[model samples]
Each structure stands twice: as C-alpha cells, then as structure tokens.
Target: MVTPDLTTSVAGIDFKNPILTASGTFGYGLEFTDFLDLNRLGGLVTKGLSAKPRKGNPPARVVETPAGMLNAIGLQNIGVPVFLEEKLPKLRAYDTKVIANVFGATEVAYVEACEMLGEAEGVAGIELNVSCPNTEEGGMIFGTDPAALGHVIRICREATKLPLIVKLSPNVTDIQLMARCARDAGADAISLVNTFVGMAIDVERRRPVLANVCGGLSGPAIRPLAVWMTWQVHQAVEIPIIGIGGIMNARDVVEFLLAGASAVQVGTASFVTPSASANIVTELEDWLSERKITSVRELIGGLELPPRG
Candidate 1:
C-alpha cells in the first residue's frame, strides 16, 4: 500500500499531520523527547504562558474520574520571557511546528504575552487560552463572554503578526457564538471546547476532591460533546477549527476531522501514554492507507448528515 498523505494546514501553518500535543499536558515539548521523536509528530503546543510566572494552585490538583481526569493546574508556567529565552531555543532543533499557548489574567496581559511570543524565533503561531479570567472585568472569563472574547482577540491581533488561534471554553450557552466572535475579532483559527468545568466530591469526607474546588474535565468522557460542538462551530464560522478534547487514538482523530476540524490536539491522553500522540500519527497513516484514502484532509467535515424533513 502507498503511503497516505497526512499533511494538513491550519491558520496557514502546515503540519506534517493533524496530530498536535495539547498545551499543559506536553510540558513545553521537551520533556517528551525520550518518549517520542518530536519530529515524527505534526506540532506541539507549549504550556499556557503568561506575562509573569505562576505558582499554580495548591496540592490535590488532579483526580481520576470515570473515563477521564480533572485538573486544576491554574495555568501554571515559567512565563513567556523565560520560555523564549530558554525552552524555545532547544525546540528549534525539532522539525515540527511549535505553537505557543498563551493566557493572561487580564486583556493587557494577554496582549503582552502575545507580543513576546510573536517576536520570538522558531515559534509557529499563538494559541490564546482565553479560558482565563479577566481580572479587569470582575473575574469574568474571556472565553465565556463574546464581547470579552472579541475584545481580547482584537487587541492580541494588533499585538502580533503571528497567526492567532482562540481556544474557546465549553462552559457557555452557545459555543458557536463564541467561535464567531473570535473569528470576527481577527482570529486566524479557533480551537474548541477547552475544558468543561466540573467538580468531584470525596463523598466519604464530604469535601471537594480538587484543592481548587473545581477543575477542567478531559478525556473520552468529553469526546462526544467536543465532536458535536466542533460540527456546530464548523457550520457557524468559515475559519479553520482545531478540534481539542479527549482524543485517544487514530479513530478519535478521524471523528474530529469528520466533524469539521482541520486538525486535532492530543490532551489528556498524553498523561496516560507519553507516546500517544506520536503513536496516533503512525496509526492514522495506516488507517487511511487501509481504506484507500489519498489524503487525510479528505476527512475534514466529511460527516454525512441525515436529511431533515
């Protein structure tokens, strides 16, 4: 069988494959070096960077659930300046794209972080983690409010020439509205369904399991919901959509592509298997070749819908 073409592009950046390691889970794309060949994968999204370093939340930040995991890491990172000065230079040796995942506590902080990443070398693009709270707006999250989301995207758009991708939060009434808002505000692409807010109680102790009281839910538990939202956003916006949620293997990646994602990010699965993303890349090629598919791009929005009466 011939080699199936797995190359795909999002926001004008070409990826060898649609598989990218999600931020926060991949640990700056350097820690996984021993586990997998970074070049074999399409790209890697760095942990969420802020203007200043963060200590993150207290202990008991992670807990296992039915078919997924919950994390309240509090967007911890070594800050944008440190990553650019240190981690990025090492990543330059890899052939894959390095997309920086940025977040801020306020609009100004967002702009500052974006500006810093945009000027750095070996950086492919910026993925804005708008799930953060806008401290200036009474703690309202930038991803949940359309206006706040648009405002942040617009300013960040001005902050850099890099391709901007808004990571949308699923804790909203309508995800499509937020996608449109990000698009209208100059986002080159949008990554959906960041993480659903959830709480796990100890029951026996009558207390919350996570120290932060609540955490982001990820893994297979949210795949169905994420796929549905991806399809919804695909119909709502014309820009590229990078589907992110609980993607475990090649089949899950195909599900997102058919649902209208130009690409997909591997998040929670990385914690379970460090080589999951790289393994999926090979499996995806084999999957396509077996079906006589020429290119993976053919699967984008390939979902067949039943006719509406």
Candidate 2:
C-alpha cells in the first residue's frame, strides 16, 4: 500500500503536511500539548506579537454568533523578547514548524519585529500581520492600501531572511491588487482572508454586544468567502497562499486547496475543539486514501470551473 504523501513546501520552507494552525488561533503552539501531539501536525503559527506586550481589549471581547464568532482580542500577546526568552525554547522542542506572526502600529515597528523574529533560532518563518492600522498613515491598515502594504513588506523583507508570509485583510476592495503588491514587495507567500469586520447588537440592552463594538468574524460562516478570495488571489499571483477563514474540517481544507491554496490554516475550529487541527490532519490523509489519491499536492488548483454561457 502506498502512503499518501502530504508534504508541501511553501515559500521555501517544507511542511510535513498542508494543514497548519492559523495565527491567533493556536495560541503559542504549546497550549495544546495536553490535547494532541504537536509533532503530528504540519506547522503552527503563533499568536500575533509586538515589540511590547499588550493588554488587549476590555472584557466581552468575544461573542458567539449563529454560524460563527466575533472577537476583538486586540492582538494581545507577550511581546517578542518574552517569546524568544520563554516561549521559543519550549516551542523548539516540538518537531513541527513554528512560524511567528508579527504585527505593529507602524512600518518601522513591523520591520523591527521582523528583524527580531528573523534572528530567533526556533522560528521556521515570519508571517507579517499587515491587518493592523498604519498609525503613521493616519490610521489606515497597511493591507488596505497597496502602496502602503508594499512599503511595509519591502522594509520587512530587508529586515528578515526568514520566509515572509503576508496575511491580507478582506476589508479591502480588491484582494488581488493587494496580493500582487505583496508579491512585488518580495513577499514569499500570502495568507488570507483575515477575519471580516463585523458587529452584533443587543437589542434588549440597546448596546453593542462586544466591548470593542466591531470585531473580526470567523468560523463556518466565512468559508465560502474565503474560498472565493483564495481563488481570486490564486489567479492573480504565483506566490504560495495559505488559505484561512472558516476551515472547520477536512473537506474545508480540500476546498481551499482545490481553489489553489498551497496550504490551509485552521482557525476558529480550534476554538470549538482544541484537537481540531490534529484531527483534520489525520482526516485529510484518510480522505485522500479513500479517494485513491497518492499525494495531497495533486489537489492544488484542481477545481474545474463550468464553461461560460
């Protein structure tokens, strides 16, 4: 019997499999130690980090929706120094790939964060969370503006030798333009669509449900939109893409890969079941084996579109 190959290389880094835990969803990659063997997974993306530790938003930061959930965690993290000093040593013990998710309020901050992560020993790659607002640009998110996004990526590129993956926001008008801009700026890969801005109100209390008022939405609700955007960006650029949004199971991962994602990230699903990522990895292999597929890579960009009338 042939063993189905799940290995995939993105931005020059080899992944044991195509299923990785998305940033901000997998915590620091150590929290799930009790739930599943971290070594069994493909890779893990850490929570977004900054130069300084953050307290995050006020309570009521998370609220459950019908088919999804909204969160305004404000990118709370232990900062880079602590991560390097405390977390990295522990994360290094795992056989799985560890990619640090970096974010900042300014382009300089982004560069600095990337430089710090680049020098870190345990990290396999650096994922730039360009979804944060560019404080120097009058509070516009870097991912929302192609020029600004390009500038940030260029500076970060100069700052790090580690493979760079830019996480794009879905709030923008044209995701393809932004993906192209990142590629032009020397990005090795791309990940999208970072949670869509959404809100829920408490009519009974006549107030916003979340403390942050508006927050990023995730879960099964956004799967279709994510697949669509991933397909659009796939058509627009040649760089590898890490599809994310609402991946909940093996089927969801297949949809993204078929739509042209080289890999897929499991986010909200982890929140429901801590072992979701590890489970999906096994499920993917099983699904492929059942279909007589020898390699998961064969599913990449395999979607067949109908002829135009």
Candidate 3:
C-alpha cells in the first residue's frame, strides 16, 4: 500500500491531496461520487456559475483541434440563488474543500455572487472567473484590462472575506501585468491560462465549427504554455499558484510542481476518464513510495535550468 503525502494547500484552502477536479470538466462536485472518492482527492472547483442560469452557446459549443479542444461554454450555470438554495446545501455533507467557481458579465454581478457565496455555509473559498468578457461594454473589456481586473477583484474582496482565487486569461500580451494586478488587489492565489482564444472549421461545410465563432482552447497543446505562465507568475508573485492545462497523470503533476505550481488542477483529462484524477493520485503515491520522496512540496521549482554553454 502506498501512502503519499497527500496534503496540499492553495488559495488558503487545504486539500487532502494535490489531485483536484478542475472546473467546467467535473460539473458539480457531487457528479464525481460514482467515479471518484471525493475525499481522497485534493478538492473540487465546481462548474463555472454566474449570477443567472445560462443555457450556454449552441450545440456545437466544443470542437477538437490538432492536440487540443476549443470551447465557448458561455459560463453556463444555475445562478447564485439556485446554487445557494439547492446545490450548496447538498455540498455541505461532503468531506472536502468546496470551492465556488463564479463568473459574471459585470462587476456588480460578481460582487453579488461573491456575497452570496460568502453567506452560504460549507463553502471553503471562492474562485473568481473574471475572464468572461463584459456583456454590456462589448467583448474587448474585462479580462484584458488591468484596471478592470482590479475593480472586479476589489469589489469582490470587499463583498466577502473568503479566500479569493482570480483566474487569469491567457489571451493577453503581458500576463505578468494581470498577475500582478490580481496580487495587488488582495487575491490570495491565482490560476493561470484560462484557455487561449481559438476556433476550428468544418472542412466539408466550410463553416466555423463552434457557433460562438471563437472559443477557449485547452488540452495537451497548451501544456507548455501553461507551465511557462505558471513559472513566470510564480517568480513575480508570493501567492500560491494552481497549475492547470493538460495535466493527465502523476508525471504531469510533478512537472507542474517543478514549474512552481503549489498544486495541480486536472481539467480536460477528467472528460477522457471520469476517474483520472484519483488514478493520478494513486500513480503519484506509487511514484513517491518507490522513490522514497517524503513530500510533494520538495519538488516545487525543482527544475534546473540548462547551462548556457
């Protein structure tokens, strides 16, 4: 039997293990009970929730690219009211850190959502999805603006006392500015590379694959990018980082750790295997046992840069 040092912390939330279910892929935390031991994993970031329920984009909302996939989920959710009244009450029974992943088209909406989560019981923390484009001000606003990012975080910060996680968008020219913006705005932690903007085409039909025209790209293709962003952000900020993007197994987890991620979040991998996160936890246990590695934190920023000959 392998006993891995499963305890991991990020955004002030303690995880049972470093293995976690990423948002959007895992649905709500309750969906994984049949496929996983929720308590065995690190924690769960629930599906992106907004101020109101959304039906999401049209049916062709997702499409596969060369080595990744593009998605425009439109942040579909059951709204804050539904989540608090119907969903959060159920999540309280589970023995794990319950993170509320929230989004909105406006700052007021975000504040309201955070306030609602703050009042709700059983919530361990709040993960802000500020990457969403502002609906009223046109699509160019929100995530890309440093000032806008700061406003959103500050409003939410004042609204609640829960640990805040500001998810960054990878579509910016200078991610460091955005990371610093979040850090300066009182965020406890940051999640990097919230999907690169991309789109695919249906060859025969000669039309855009996804009805949204453009969608966020994720999966193996963006792995290297994610690592680089995590490393850069790690060097710039003191807050813990949650490395996501193309993490499929223990090896990937170790890679993220070396890249300066405090812990790892499994996203697209969950779709391929409902039990992928737990399997990764097992594999990590086996790897650590065989190597006699005591704690996973020892591996953080452990990567050695190549010598310039």
Pick the lDDT winner: 1
Which has the higher lDDT value, candidate number 1 or candidate number 2? 1
Per-residue CA lDDT of model 1 for 1-309, tens digit only, reads 889989999999999999998888999999999899999989999988888998888878889998998888877789999999999999999999999998888889888888877768899899989874212221137888889889989999999999888888888999889989989999999987787888899999999999888888899999999999999999999999999999999999999999999999999999999999999999999999999999999999999999999
lDDT tens digits, residue span 1-309, model 3: 446576878877888777777788888877888898877677788888877787776667888888788887777778878888887788777787878888876788788778777757788888888674312322235678999888888889899899998888877988888899999998999987678888788889999888888888888899999999999988889898888888888988898989888888899988888999889988988888888888887887788899999
What CA RMSD would candidate 1 show? Answer: 1.8
Worst 10 residues of 3 by lDDT: 132-141
Better of 2 and 3 by TM-score: 2
Look at candidate 3 and give me any clashing residue pairs.
Answer: none
lDDT of 3 at 51: 71
| Residue 99 alpha-carbon offset, candidate 2, angstroms | 0.5
Give lDDT: candidate 2, residue 238: 96
lDDT for 88 (candidate 1): 94
Q: Which of the predicted structures, 2 or 3, would earn the higher lDDT when compared with the native? A: 2
Residue 32, candidate 1: alpha-carbon lDDT: 96
